[model samples]
Structure formats: structure tokens, C-alpha cells
Target chain A: MALNIKPLSDRVVIEPAAAETKTASGIYIPETAKEKPQKGTVVAVGKGNKDHDMTVKVGDEVLYGKYAGTELKLEGKDYLIMREDDILAIV
Target chain B: MALNIKPLSDRVVIEPAAAETKTASGIYIPETAKEKPQKGTVVAVGKGNKDHDMTVKVGDEVLYGKYAGTELKLEGKDYLIMREDDILAIV
Candidate 1:
């Protein structure tokens, strides 16, 4: 949880929810068929832009659109960097 | 521009900005090396959800993340569907 990256201008860095490994019935789901999880925890936040203020903060669980954000790797850990607008809802 | 598909629940459809075919230096860029455009025009918008109200309207030009949205083909035309948050700034 100690990364030096700071988001700028409405950008955010998030740790995505872990991918589901098993089905509701306890059957193991293959990686290829597993739906990519759209939920994540905000790790870092950015200052609001000129017209909009950010509504989320660190540690907020958020739902984002599927396929949103550019994937990144920091110290062998996966992260996503996206504009605040890409976050759909705070859960 | 006459598509009947309407976005729902803060989802939006966008017509992406045209990809750059030539560099500012007038050299033609090959298809494989071209950067995807991150700007687009909003074609459709959805109603705001419980915690958020839609801040964009039809015909608003927006800036987005490089990899935001899902690509779709509608009536032989290309479109992107994404949550309202996928849009970074209105221009």
C-alpha cells in the first residue's frame, strides 16, 4: 500500500477486486471464461479538474465499467490508472 | 447518426475522434503504430443513477482515457459504450 505514484487531474489508481476463482456451485471456473471483475478499491486519488470535483477517496470500493482504464504494474502488483469519470459508482 | 440504440443508467455511446493518419510533421503513420484517439462526441446518454446525476448531454465532445469503453458495431458503424465516468472532461 506504499506506492509513490500520485494521480493527477482526476486520475485514480485502483487495486482491482480479485478475480473469481469458483462458481456459486463450487465448480472451478477456467480463466478464459471468467468474467473480469469490475469492482476495485481506490488506492490513490487526484485533484478535481476545473469544472468537476472528485467524489471518491482512498479506500472506497468502486464499480467501474468493464474494460475501463489502462492496466499497470507497480512492484509486481497490478493496478489500474483511469480518469475519475471511468468510475461508475462508489459502493 | 440515426441509430436507435439508447444507453441506460449512465451508460453512453460515443463516436470516437478520428485516428491520426499523419503525424504533425506530415509523415504518414502506419496503422499499427497509430495511437488511439481519446476524444469523442457523445451520441447518447443515460439517466443518472441514485448517487449521481448525468452531467453530460447529447452532442457534447469529451476526452476519455486511452483504453476506455467497449467497442461495438452498430449498423456497420463503430461506436463505444461506456459509463459516464469513462468520460474525463468536456471540451
Candidate 2:
């Protein structure tokens, strides 16, 4: 069951564990040997904050840490619960 | 030459590119085919913001994204320039 979660106040909703299978060198990494990329697909994004301006949006692919944001599981899929500040880059 | 940077106001200095090399299945991945983990080590930590309380410090292993934070290089080592908020978990 996919959740229709709306992030509040500079927070972003991310689908975790969706990582690229290859490195920049074009090597094929098996799932059993792949490192967790600090990457995700933006499912939902929150409004900008009063202090810092928000620059990302939904559907934007992003990079972040494995242990950076709070982890939540909805319908068996892992998702990240993080503030906008925790977001590192938009790809 | 490593930089002794003092982050200002809730920013965190992270040494990027240091990630776990194996998946849960314990497969051996070569560096040539590893995905970028959104994980890093806290090199320097900033003081808490006036609004949100700061909870992490230097030397803490943290996770973030490849595209989540700003990137910087010092003496060829890639580092991440991010706010404290970008840090997701403390490992």
C-alpha cells in the first residue's frame, strides 16, 4: 500500500533502497555486493522554510545518507523521513 | 592538505565517499562497480541553530546523499558541504 504522505515544513518524502546497480566505471554489481547509495527518488516534497529556501520537488532524484534521515516503512517499502536540510543534492 | 574548517551555524563538514562495501547478503563488490552511498563521517560539526536543536558532533558516522549536499574537494579528497539538517542518521 503506497502512502499519500504530504511532508510538512521543509521535509521531504523519499522512497529508500532504490539504488543504481552500477558505478561510474560501468561495472555490474550484484545485489549481494552493492553498497547502499545515498540516493533516492523524491516522492513528495514540502514547502520552503522561512529561513532557508527550498529548491527540490517531487520526482526529483536525490542523494542522501543511509543513516541520515529517519527511516519509516509503509506497506513493506522503506522510506525516509527527513527535513529539507538533510537533503544533500538533487540529481 | 586537509583543511581545518570551522563550520558556521549548523553546518556540518563531512568526509564524503567513505561507505560500507557490502550488501546484506555479504557480496564482495569492487570499487569499480560500487554505488555511491549517502554515508559519510562527520569531520567537523557546527553549533545548533536558534530554532532547531542540534544533536550530532564530530567523528560521528552519518548518512546522506550523493546529490543531497553541496560538494567540495580538499587536496583531492571529496567532501560534502551540508547543513546539520541534511544529516539523517548517526552511525
Candidate 3:
């Protein structure tokens, strides 16, 4: 988590949760059938934009859209960069 | 455009601009070659969320991400519904 990543106004950096490998019934789900993870922990937050304030903070668990954010890799880890508005809820 | 559609909570309704059919050099680009339009006019907007205030308004021209928003059809016209945060800049 020490890759020195910073987001701009109204943007955030997140560490995505791992996708589920098994179903509730204990049935194994193949890697190709697993859904993309939609939850993550906030790693960094930017200052509020011209009109939007920074309400979400680092360490907060958040839910975002399935297609929200841009994916990137740093230090062999995955990260997502998205505007705060892309977040659906603070879990 | 009177489809009676309304957005809720930081969402907005937009009418996408038509895709370009011609290149800048006066070459006619086939329908399959045109890029999706990323600009649109706001038709309606929702109230801001608890932590975010609505800064965009109806009739405002906006720039958005290429893949942003959900597309829907109403009254035989196409529309896009997206969170206000998806809007990049007011044009």
C-alpha cells in the first residue's frame, strides 16, 4: 500500500477486494465465472472538487459500480482510480 | 424529449450528441467507424446526495467519459442516465 499514489480533486484510490471463489452452497466457482469485485477499501482521497466535498476517507470500505474506475497496477498490486461519485455506498 | 423521466440522487438525464459521420478532412466516415459521442446536454438532474451537492443543471452542455452512463430509449429517442460525477466538465 506504499506505492505513493495520489488522486486529484474528487478522485480516490482503492484497493479492491478479492473476488469470491466459491458460492454460498460451497460449490467451487471457476476463475472465469467469478464476478469482478465491486467493493474496496479506500487508500487515498483527494480534496473536494469545486462543488463536491470529500466525505469518504481512507480505510473506509466502499461499494462502487461494476464498471466504475480505471484499473492500474503498482508494485505488483492492483488498484482502481475513480471519482467519488462513482462510489455507490460507504460500507 | 418529454418522456417524463426523472433521475434520483446525483443522477442526471442527458441527450447524447449524434455520432460524427464525416472526418475532419471532409472524408465520409462510415457509420461503423464513428466514435461514440461523449458530449451531451443535460435534460434533468437529481438532488444531491447527503455529502454531495448538485452542481450541474438542466440545459448545461457537458463532457463525459466515453463509456459513462446507461443508455435507455424513450419516445423513440435515446437518453443517458449517469451520476453527476460522470460529467467531466461543463461546456
Candidate 4:
């Protein structure tokens, strides 16, 4: 999907993985038990600032801090915008 | 005081302002009521990485987030080490 907004500085736009609704054993999980997913696909990246280089590219799956990033919606889909440093690693 | 350690990769060593121990009226404040100081002096700064430049200089007074940085002790003094981005502004 094309992104309408571009993040400035060292920020990136990510498409977070959908929250799990059930356990692998088929047990239903409650909303309160659902933790934010730390994994996402890089959708858009910024031109890095002078001190750092952009390490992850579009389409890279990455893990980030559980509480990292700002939440936003684009075309009714949830997305996260955060600095690349918030991403812990590329998976 | 001299800092024996040098920060790396956009990190900075800051000497945090002492926490307020009493109210303006001279009433003693409880430990739980004392909030972390958001101000500090830049003691050391890392060389800017490829993407960004060092905006602050040594001895510059700056404001940072209350919970920002890692705590450490050197020569019986407290210090915080954090990324320059964590500093909100130079005052």
C-alpha cells in the first residue's frame, strides 16, 4: 500500500502485525490480555539524519520495543510511526 | 569535576541537577513526592554519528525527560547517560 504521509528525520512508518485473538491451543484471549505486538513490517523509512544511517529498508520485518512509536491510522489501517532506533532488530 | 568516561555514538554524559528536597516555604518534601529533575549539564558528548551533528556543547545546560537516561555513579557523584535525542532542549 502506498503511504500518504512521509516521516521526517530518522522516523519510519511501520505496519504492525495484527494482534492475536486466540492462543495456539485455540483458547480465546481477552482484550486486556492482548499485548501490543513488537513486530512489524517496515512500510516507509526516512532519510536518516547526519548522525545515523538507515539500516532497515522497506519490507524488512523488525522487532521493536513494546511501547515504542506513535499510533495512527491511514485509510482505516493502523500504523506506527517511530524513530528507527526504536526498532530493536530486523527479523 | 572531570569525567573519566567518554560517550559514544550520539550519547552524552550529563550531571543531573540535584533533586529538590524541600518546598519553597521550607517544608520538607517526602521522598515519594520528589520528582526527578529534568535539567542537567552536559559533561561529555559523543562525536556525531554519520546522520546527525552534536547540537550541544560541554557545560551547556539542557532539559531532558524526567525518566530519560541510564543512571551511573562516578567519583561519588551521580550521572546520567543518554542519547542526545532524549534531551528536549538546551537552556
TM-score of chain A of each: 0.80, 0.71, 0.80, 0.80
Best by DockQ: 4
Report lDDT per candidate: 0.71, 0.62, 0.71, 0.71
Which residue pairs in candidate 3 have backbone atoms (N, alpha carbon, C) closer than 3 angstroms, thus clashing?
Answer: none
lDDT of 4 by residue, A1-91 (tens): 5554545557788998666644344534235435777777898886677667899999887778878986644455677778899999876
Q: Report DockQ per prediction, comma-separated.
A: 0.03, 0.03, 0.02, 0.04
Candidate 3 residue B80 Cα shift, in angstroms, is 0.6
Residue B14 local lDDT, model 3? 91
For residue A75, what is the lDDT in candidate 1? 49
Which lDDT tens digits does candidate 1 get at residues B1-91? 5468888887889987676533222322224324677666788888867855677788876656667899989888788999977775554
Report the lDDT tens digits of candidate 4 across residue range B27-57: 2222332467666679999997876677778
Local accuracy of candidate 1 as per-residue lDDT tens digits, A1-91: 5455556457888988777644334543235434667777898886765666999999888778778887654445677778889998876
Candidates in order, TM-scores: namely 0.46, 0.44, 0.46, 0.44
User: What DockQ class does candidate 3 belong to?
Assistant: incorrect
User: Ten-residue segment with the worst summed lDDT in candidate 3 chain A?
Assistant: A21-30
Which digits, one per residue and each the tens of the lDDT, describe model 2 over residues A1-91? Answer: 2245545446777875444554344534235434655767777675555676778877777767556766644344567768777877775
How accurately is candidate 4 docked according to DockQ?
A: 0.04
